[model samples]
Target: MDFVPLWAVVIDYILGVVMWTLIGRFGMGLFLPENTSFFFMRFFVQATDPLIRLFRPITPGFLDARFVPLFVAWFFYMARFYLMPWLLGYSVMGMLSFPLEGEIARGLANILYKFQN
Candidate 1:
């Protein structure tokens, strides 16, 4: 296997962790009010704020500012499912798309597939 694809897979895992954290932060916000003093909430906000800011201008105005996390998550989803594979010269559908489960499973599967051949 090429190093480029392996590097892409590592990035995929990192994106998965960040994407899920963004989703969790958004979901938690629905129940708990924002308080910087709170640990998890603060961590979530600090962790995801930069990413949200990076995407905010491009995200549709119709989307409320509070939905920035979701918007960024969508961007990551697109990168993982579409952009990465395209860059690697593979069709989007040819690679495992869902990132919530982490990349270990996919990486292991790739190793096993290579061994099988």
Candidate 2:
């Protein structure tokens, strides 16, 4: 009775990655311009450009270019945090809704607890 659908996990993980990538891009953009030649900045731009373009139709013109990554990331976060759980018939975001971050947090906590003891 504790099983969650594999499809649900995959979708949650995919959305999680996109959300983090967008967040990372936003964080990097704060200190680096879009035209920077640095590999990491370039990689963020390359990875998230398609997503930004996909959401341009819904993105507000009033928002600044530097904020687009975060704006896009919010949608993914919303879908993962709310939609997935609802779709899975969960009243809250349980493990199924946040498998990626949830497991990572749990693993880190265990590691820290062991170290502390």
C-alpha RMSD of each candidate structure in angstroms: 6.1, 2.2
What would you estimate as the lDDT of candidate 2? 0.90
Candidate 1, residues 1-117: lDDT per residue as tens digits?
344556777778887888888897887777676575778988888898888878767988888656778778877777778877777787545374544464467888899999999
Evaluated at residue 13, the lDDT of candidate 2 is 87
Residue-by-residue lDDT tens digits, candidate 2, 22-80: 99999999999988999999999999999999999999999999999999999998898
- The best candidate by lDDT is 2
**Superposed Cα deviation of residue 100, candidate 1 (Å):** 6.6
